[model samples]
Target chain A: MKKIIAGAAYVVGDAIDTDQIIPAEHLVYSLSDAEERRYYGRYALSGVPQGQQGLPYGDRPFTAPNAFRSEYAIVVGGSNFGCGSSREHAPFALQEAGCAAVVAESYARIFYRNAVDGGFIVPFESIERLLERVRTGDLLEIDTSLGKLSNRTTGEEFLLKPLGDVADILKAGNVFEFARQAGFMPA
Target chain B: MTITEKILARRAGRDRVAPGDNIWVDVDILMTHDVCGPPTIDIFRREFGADAAPWDKEKLVIIPDHYIFTKNHHANRNVELLRAFAAEHDLPYYYDPGTPNYKGVCHMALAEEGFNLPGSLLIGTDSHTCTSGAFGMFSTGVGNTDAALIMGTGKIWLKVPETMRFVFEGSLPPYLMAKDLILQVIGDIGTDGGTYRALEFDGEAVYDLPVHERMTLTNMAIEAGGKNGIIPPDEKTFEYVRERTDRAFEPVYGDPGARCHSVRRYRVEEIEPLVAKPHSPDNRATVSEVAGTRLDRAYVGSCTGGKLEDFVAAANILRGQEVAIDTYIVPATTWIGEQLHSTRVEGDTLYEIFERSGCKLGQASCAACLGGPSDTFGRTHGSEVVISTTNRNFPGRMGSKQASVYLASPYTVAASALSGRITDPREALV
Candidate 1:
């Protein structure tokens, strides 16, 4: 049985980019396996203290640290999630940081395709329930195959159904492998 | 056939195509970058089981464009990993060459190096990859995984897009450049008007414009939700390719009888300085609407805005006046930077004029426009509004989430930097 080991959950506001997930200045480290925590820090509201109010930083629902600190199989976010360049680094960085999935209200088209192709799970979860059950650092178990998300804190279970072709890609371990099974290539 | 129709036909297995055809065609050329390549490579190798890689190494071009100029050690190491992978895979065009390192920016480097052949279909991992369409190729941006799959298979599928033709008939006004012209087009079409379509530019205006100017027109085609924007090959096209490449020239043109779904024309003299306000590129307003607005930073860099003509235009405007307090200008590519640095115009390079006017130059690599590590607006305590010469100005694109970014041409950005407020270059140009 394939299982999702939920870990720390780091919540973020809308409109995150690959550069903020990992700055362009960090492009030099493409080959290395080093980990980047708070890679999206520069673009975060709390990250830039002084200019916090001018942009839509304060009203964003995901700024609370305790909500994002948890280790989980799923990371939930607001609408228009990952809306910018087709940079694949955004989803890759999140998955590498121990996030098995990113459940958001919406996703940029390119980012959506890149995520599924990389074997990372990006599902659109209930923004309301996701905001309520998970806080930073609380472990939650998500079984996409089973479509269940359990909040360990309150013993609450949330239903999740993978939409579109994302579920198929995740099940096959990535797009290329799926292609191979589909006879896209000669063995 | 025109260069565009020829290229599309080669992929579509048809001599010609009309608008509104739902057809899947094969990608002609594919590209990737280091950031997304490693993972895609990992997936590719796993799926293929490593006995043999999927695609021809020569056809795959991978370079590190995002963090080529980095202060971070980790990011630098990542680049090294990619370099090693390129070598291991025997990828021919593996590195970027220039003063800060490579010739300048990747797209410009590719253009100058002649990797972009006319009538070829090009794809890359960055959205700005469409910049190459200036060379009269069908180029667009995709995800790393998509690129990796193409790397392994040597082919990918794409839905043939309907092409919308824009005909420009007259010469541009003294102050307006290609950037202004694109803004005018976008404003007319509105965002989402061309969603999932191709924009084919024609008429005397497009043919008369320079190569770099053509690039500016096509680069923003993505902003209009276009798959690829193209200009048919002509005498100018042949000249550009002959100068940069050794490949035997093959002239491609769209048939005069080639069917176009929609056609529209504009007089170049009718356009004005335009700006795409925050949140969307389609949210356009004339420069007159936003002029005199104070700015914290006036950036003139990015694939769309960074070019020799752009640099010359900005330098001409700021030649006598000093940049207002807190204004910064960054050239998009290192080659452009060096060109500006070593270039001698009136006893000085454009860099000299920019530096003398209280402005400091940032390196190439999409700096400032995409928000580099050191470049930020609003100081540490207060928020700032930036008027950039780049293509996009969506929220949080420049630096802070709170900062307001207004997109314009190099002329407008430079004029604003001089006057300490957004102003059209037409008013200040003599």
Candidate 2:
């Protein structure tokens, strides 16, 4: 796995829960065949406020139809990201949506584990200052090997926690795959 | 070491284990419900080969509770998948819907069926799997892949969590319930305060609470980011388990000098009814702080609030009074609904109370808690303001993003339903 990746950031506020990531009404699609699972990515941030008056990014959905062109490879969040529910679909949706990493001041424990176990996306823990240093469209660079996050746009840099075993899991493409490599599963 | 440490150390076959130590341990039971089960089965078949069988069929319990009663094709398909999987696998513990062997919510049904034995390590696909910890077991929720992995290997790797002790003293006030106490704790600790930590609840108030009420405390630990919430077993736990199952088990307890990461105390006498306002479980406030707020709906049901005692509390308030707002009452299990039909309080059965108050009674399943399909009864639609007994109040939790949800106790919800506003239960009790 490459230790460094850079892209535009999609910023969200605190306590963005599983319900918002993917509502229960859409869970049936999650159980469908592989082709249908893309709906999870399509509706990743469906619950996020869009086109609401007096909020940031008015009239623009978080992940618009042209989101691939916008290229939000990273998601930055405030405290307690993924706070409710143990659904892996939260991270699955983000991974399907082309999000490579999530940097947050803090995260719900279950979400962190699901991200690692599924090897869906990288989860980074940053200080509260990171939220202030980066904006929605800011080009940010994260280097997991060096535990550093550099803001390519502003030339500012911040520190990130090391990935530890999580990097190995992601390199192996998920826990089950890693288990097979480590001889925990049938060869 | 704390009780959690002791249990983990034993299961991992270690002399001593501390927080942050990752070790693989054998699981006693694995629970999966309709919504999460299909994906889990998919992963199991995909990863382990379609010809592979479960490691232990008896240890895997599948209950179709979330989308059972709904009319949606997809929702019903999830159940059908589970049913076919159970039939193919010959799984003995599968609780089918609309059958004599059907159970209610997986958490409560696990308890009623004696799967919540003390000193056991239980995992479920649903977040409220901590509800089993009320029986002195080490239980927590995991994602679909982890559940499927356990279904294949019957073992999982877990990082040991540090323990936080919360002691509650003094007797609870008449109107104050366990729901208020947990909401107060979550508010104080913030949503992520207990991240990767075990919450050990003790003290006079917790011990005095009924087993059902104690289950409420453990059930909400996940809301505070707890790995698991546990209560030491006592006579109440033993009697409850004995009545449900004849299985013999030893109870685990924390040592007197157990090392704790932090210790917090609360006085039950000083506590008051509380509510988690719209959009967040930690956005808590006193019922008085938001009193007289008009409501369009009042819902009482879920693993957190749909127990027999919860219905009894609401019945006490709605017996003679007519509901001013649309009220939905759902029992957590079929047995609870049957109890409502067979038992009477103050010469009026719970069914009669629902009839007299014009409340819509629902089957024993997680009806409106997860914002079921469009046809699901009592689901919030449009911009209606609702007072619910369900756990989460996040946007679109019950149904519509335009709707606002306030989480409270059954007493508070019932009282509010009577007046079409958020009224404290004490006023109704008076």
Candidate 3:
């Protein structure tokens, strides 16, 4: 696992569901087809309402207009993030758009499982309302080993909840790799 | 242990298990649909090698339902992917599109096709997979990666969730359906109140409902962030299962002194028709509180509210009445669609009532419920306000993000449709 993940923060409020992460209409493209899968990144965070797009300022799209990749690498959110649909496309879209980690007050179960098991991104729970503290474009650094996050732009740091049971899966990159190490699959 | 714990214990080959214990469970069924099926297939192939076969073919149920009515080439191609994979594997339960064996809206179809058995462990690639727990089983949604793991090994690890039982006392009123009860629970507990927990429905009122109605209560468990929702298996459950499948199974229940996270009791008579206001299923208010709120459209459909009984309830309010605003009726499955032609209200069939009421009828599928390709039937294009019986009212759920949706029971939807506003069901039913 990477010791330090540093990037621009993209922030959103509570109950940011899978629909807003990646709309259902964009779900048709094959995730396995290299060319088609790029569409996921292009539309990542596109379904957020026009007013709630990028947080404090709002109306700031996560991905550049018509671009496949996003400028923001780390996402900060309020409570109950990724709360709807079991669509793995939500996390896949974020990762495809170059997201490295998500720090939120909480997460819906399915979304948390998908992120950790798919090795799409590291999902961390912060002890405080990180979205309120971090701006959409603030520079942030997260250390997975210590569960500490620092907002370099503001020169303040926050503590993240321990990875606990999921740290084993994250350390192995994904469930498939973890299972292999555990002798459930051939290495 | 609660019923959910008991079921998980049996599946894990253990005599007893407690909440928070991580155990490897042998699942009995894994269902997938078009939207997530191709990706799951891709992951399964990539991890297990291109030529590796699933641990068991018959146990995997693939039903292509979502994005079925669209002209979008990509969406259409997904069904083809499922077809080619099913043919290659010679899977028996693949319900091919445009065939006589086609089923619609997988959650309901699972029950119709006999895959939803009592005391079994079912995991699906869709969130609403909790609907199967209505049959007194342990069922929950998992993503493609977890689903692929189950496909390759028929086993997945789980943390046993503590149970929170809701017992509905008294009799259900004529205007208040099971949808109101679930919306009420979600409203009281906030969206994540049930996180990592099992929600079990009990008491006389829940048992009095038809087996199909009980499904509506369990279908939206995910909206509450619940792991699973269940009702202890009763004679009604046994009859529903036996009528559809002869699969011999033992029905399990919680021990008399089982541990629980919480228990809530409600007297059905005190409840009124309810709706989850725009943007979230937990944003709840009584129908009277939001009555007369203008709506551009009214829809009655989806796995949660698009059953034969739901249509009957709607038709009762819509008989001899014309909807003032645009309205749509989508049956959850092909069988339910056929039933709409025979099921009657007064002298009119439910289909006839919808036709005469100026409501646009749609084919049996998950059309517009989750906002498929832009051309999907009844999809909102702009800032239209909609009152719908579908689960989930999140932004862009039915199409345009600007469009707002109020989630309500079919009776309330029908009543509101007749008035061109969010009206209480009692206004028309009484």
Candidate 4:
């Protein structure tokens, strides 16, 4: 895991589902192909309603026009982030769009598992709802080791919930690596 | 321990289990559809070596249901990918398109093909895999990485989820369907109310449902962020499984004193016909509250509502009336489609009723449910408003982010089709 992740925070409200993260239509593209996969990045959070795309102010696009990646490296969201489908494309889309980590109050189970187990993104649970506290495009820094977030824009510091047993898998880089290291499979 | 824990314990070779207990259990079945199958197969080969065979091909069921009828090259390639993988593995349970074995929509097909035996730990690569829980099994959805790991190891470690008991007292009313009961639960509990927990259905009304209807209850467990929806196996369950598959399964039951993290009860008669408004399944309102709301389209399909029984409900309402708007009737599987020809209701075949009512019937597949490709049948575009029997009303779920979708039971959707508005079924039924 990176020691520090610093970038502009893109915030959203609760129940930001998989469809909004990456719509089902874009899922037809291949995730294995480096070129084709960028569509996932291009369409990241494309399904979120125009008004809910960015926090504080509505209608803020995650990525620049026609760009494959977003400027934001960290996402601050409310509860039940990634709520709908079991699609791993949800997290993969964030990663494809250059998002390194997400800080939400809570997460849907499958999305949390996919984020952690796939090693696509570090899903950090904030101690409290951060969307209201942080604004979209607000510069923020996270100390991954300490599980702490610092709002560079507001000078507010908050503690995040520990990753627990999942951190070990995250450290190993993915579930397959962790499984092999744990002697569950042949390395 | 509840039945979910008991079933997990039996597979883990333990006497009992509880919430938050992580144990590795052997998978009786690992089901995958076209959408996730290719990626899973790719990861399996990457991790387990390109030449390594699956842990058990027979236990791996591949049904190419999603994106089957699309003209998109990528979508077609996905089905071909599944076909090639099944060919290389010689998997016995591959439901390939263009063949007699083809079955549409993985969830309902799983039940129809007898893969949904009670007490079995069935995992699929679709969120609605919980639909199989109707047969008294432990089934849930997973992503590609975990699915690939199980594909190679035949094992998965699941944290035991605390059960949330939802009981519906009194008998099911004439105008209501299982969809209404589940919708009411989601409305009460919110979407994340059951997050990381098992949502178990109980009480008189639940048991009164036929096996197919019971699936409607379990199908949307994910809509409320549930780990899985389960019901204790009873004679109705056993009889359903027995007729489907002769495979011996020792069904487990919850202890009488088993405790749940939370419990909610409702009297079926008191609940009105419900419809979840646009944007979320938990954004629910009674049908009458939203009645007269104009609708441009009405859809009745997907694993949650495309069963033979679901079609019957729709057919009953559309039997003698001309629809006021565009209505789509897509069966979940070809078998169900065939049954439409064979199953008669009120002196006419369901096919005859639907066709005569000016409804456009579609081929058996997950058409427009996940908004696959541009030309998907029944998919919405622009700002069209739709009321559908399928689960999920999140933006773009049916194709257009601009479009609005209302989730309701087949009866409500059918009745709404007649008036081009969100009308309560009681108005049409009575």
Candidate 5:
């Protein structure tokens, strides 16, 4: 069963790309499966983490020691989330690291589709509302049925009329499940 | 109906489609590369369970351009797996590093080899695969899993995007090129303005452009949220395909009454050298706005920037001049690198000219574009800005996340590299 975690928000600045999600140096490793995600932090930042002995790409911003960790499943971000490179491993890396949904002001069309098809619910929301929720680390619940984002911590809720069938796909799990439920067969 | 309308129509089971009608048409050519191939194939294998033979293998083309020479054992493992799949399927066109038949990059090679023809729908597990629209084909990128499913079924569904007609008039300026034109369009439309829209390049300016230059325009259309940027077939396109491909057919053109939901016009004579400043491809401005910003690097390579004309253009400017202290010149493909060596003027090849200018000509690959394959800008804390010819100046696109990338045309990039700052190529031209 898919867990729809609501509440707790972390704010990421604009244009988050695959390099931040998973560094090219670490791309040499097996990316087929999801594993220990704490290591993902070492990659997201520009400098190396203390414990990791040998990482070429410097310590990333999205690390554990820095602010914004797995405490929040909802990530509110600036425009163009997952903008560069059509690396699906990026979504896999982000999801494995405990982000359930990403609320962005806007998303690169390819990244937006990649996230939805990869099973992460990336809903487009107003930048002001997202910033407000992230500033407080507020609790927000997404009622998929009604397509609304309710910030329990601030008592502020807004309707996020979901992107084309994204709500239905989210309810059915990943694209594979959505395709199955939609009665699509491999021709 | 023409080939495009017929193919899309037959797939939709309709005679023709007017603009704005969302029809899920069958995909014609499906392509994939190494990075996405492994995961996508994993899904296909799991779904098929040893009986996975479903799609026609001939239509599938797999090319591994990124990490062509794997850095280590782990990277090598992924290469092996992608190779194994190609071998297992007996895929006719598989490009491993060892294959002499390999072309430089998939998008460039696809057009060069003639897989991308007028009126075909090409889907790839690559965002830049839309670069094939230079041939007047409709191409778009898909995720790895979608690629896998398409590989299995030999088809995937697509919404026929509403076509936007960009009618261009007037001749291109001497220093101006298609890259500048695209930056101008991106400036007007912004990034998301053309979301899910097909851009049809029309008018005299597009007609005047050489095939390669036309490619430069279509390739960056994706940067502006475009599905495909197209140019109706012309004599130049027919000549290019005739010379490049063995199997020939008559050219196809957009119908006289071709339905376009939105039609816009651009006068090329009035357009200037344009740049998309740091952060987004759509954050565009004229070269005048951001000129003279000191640049640490000036790149002239990518599916968008690297071409024979780009090399010829840059070499013409720097033939008798010295490269700026910090400038670097990297070709986008090995084939082009060899071609540059063979291009001679006044008893000197272009490579010699570049080397004499104190510019370093590096190997072909996506250098300094996506970070970490070469001398990425901001090698130290102080190195701050770069003027590059590659597309997408998003943060960390050049090197360090803190550094800024300024996008420009090949002429602008080369001129800037010689000037040690961003200078209009027209101003610097001899």
Candidate 6:
């Protein structure tokens, strides 16, 4: 686990559900096949509404070509991020798209757990004020050890709650790996 | 502690546990459907070694429900993978497709098979696993990874969640169903209100609801971010459970002074028919507010809305009338389909009533609910607007991303189908 992570932020509004993260139509692909699983990253955030003039990430698919060239390592969201469905593909798709973490005012319970258990991505809860201080493409630095987030572009800092045991799971790169290390399985 | 705490405490071998207390509890049953089963099997084999056997194969139930009926290769592969795994393990509870043991939806099948006993701890890969909570059990949904771990170990680590008690006072109105009550609650609390919390429903209204209808309340608990929605088992519950299985089990209830994080009261008399508008379950409004909203399609099925009671409600409205728009009716399970075909509403069978009304009857499965494949029967394509009895209305949840979905009760959907618009059930019922 990196003590401090710095990356570009991609901002989204409230209630971005799992369906929007990865649509159900794409759920047929088997993860056992690596080639099929990679399709998830290409389809990540493909369900997010496009051609909306005012919304963030509007008129653009999260998987659009060159979208990752901006290096969006963090996703900043409003309340109730990952609000619907229990599809782990939601976080897996985001992680596949090179998103290291998601910072939101709140998260749907299952998504929060999936992100932790699968070690797909780090889910951070912060105040709504952080939404105003951060912008898309802003240089955001997160210190997981200190529970602090700093926007280097704006020089604004926000406090995040400690990750506790979740940090350990993330460090081990998923629940299965952590289970093996913790003597839950034969290593 | 609340009933949820008590059950978890007992399962964890602790006299009592509070909210946020992490403990390992024995799982009585671990369920998986086609969409999630293959990955769970793959992961379990990967981590525990392919040659390693499951902790207890009898406790693991696999039902190939979601995409079994479809002809798509990828969708069919998931079932193949599950069938292969079940054969290798000689699992007793594998519900194979096209077999007499085939059950449709995992959640409904679990209940029909008598797996959801009182005081039990069950986990499934599907979010609606909370549907079993109607049996006075503590059940919730977990991801594939967790299901795999549970399959290998028969134990899961869980943090006990605080409880939210909803007390429904007074007799429920004739037109108001459990769907309305739950939609109203979700609308009031917002989708994330009950995040990581157990929602317990009790009161004269809940007690009066039949076990099947009570399952509807618990089924949508996940819509409000509930870890599980439970109702204390009474005579109705015992009668239902006993008919299915004679297994003696102790029912658990909240303490006389069990502390809840929040207690909310609803006067059933005041609740009218409700609908969760497009894109979000919490985006709710009165059916009257959106009345006369034209629809491209009407769907009546899912774990939340596809039960015997739901079919009866729809049949009551569609008995003599013909549908004005395209409509699809899917039973939650194969047993439910059998019930619809065998039982009569008025002089006509429920199946005949639906077919006579020009509704496309689908076989028992999660058809068009998860947007199935392109060939899925009655799946919404393009930018059509659909009024569905299914649980979710998330973007692209049913099929096309451009399709708009409005979720309501089966009665509301059936009535609306007759007029090709969103109509309040009272308009037809009264």
| Per-residue lDDT of candidate 3, residues B151-232 (tens digit) | 8989898999999989999999988899999999999998899998999999999999999999999998888999999989
Model 2 agreement with the true structure over A74-160: per-residue lDDT tens digits = 888878888888988888888887788999888898888898888778889895446666777788899878878888889988898
Q: Residues B241-333, candidate 6, lDDT per residue (tens digit)? A: 888887678898889889899999989999989999988888999999999999989999988888999999999999989999999999989
lDDT of 5 by residue, A1-187 (tens): 2334585665666555555556544544444454423344334323212222111222223445543245556766666566556666666656655667777777766777777766754555553536534442567777655667777877877776455546565566666666666556532
lDDT of each: 0.66, 0.87, 0.93, 0.92, 0.68, 0.86
Q: Relative to the true interface, what fraction of contacts does candidate 3 keep?
A: 0.89
lDDT of 3: 0.93
**DockQ score for candidate 5:** 0.30
Model 6 interface RMSD, one decimal: 1.2
- Of 1 and 2, the candidate ahead on TM-score is 2
DockQ of 2: 0.71
Pairs of colliding residues, candidate 3? none
Could you tell me the interface RMSD of model 5?
A: 3.6
Better of 2 and 3 by TM-score: 3
Where model 4 places Cα greater than 4 Å from the true spot, the runs are: none
RMSD of 2: 1.9
List TM-score (chain A only) for every prediction: 0.70, 0.86, 0.98, 0.98, 0.71, 0.87
Instruction: Compute each candidate's TM-score over C-alphas.
Output: 0.79, 0.97, 0.99, 0.99, 0.89, 0.96
**Superposed model 3: Cα runs more than 4 Å off:** none
Worst lDDT window (10 residues) for model 5 chain A? Answer: A48-57
On lDDT, the candidate that comes out on top is 3
Off by over 4 Å in 6: A52-57, A65-71, A180-183
In angstroms, the error of model 6 at B285 is: 1.2
Clash pairs for candidate 2 = none
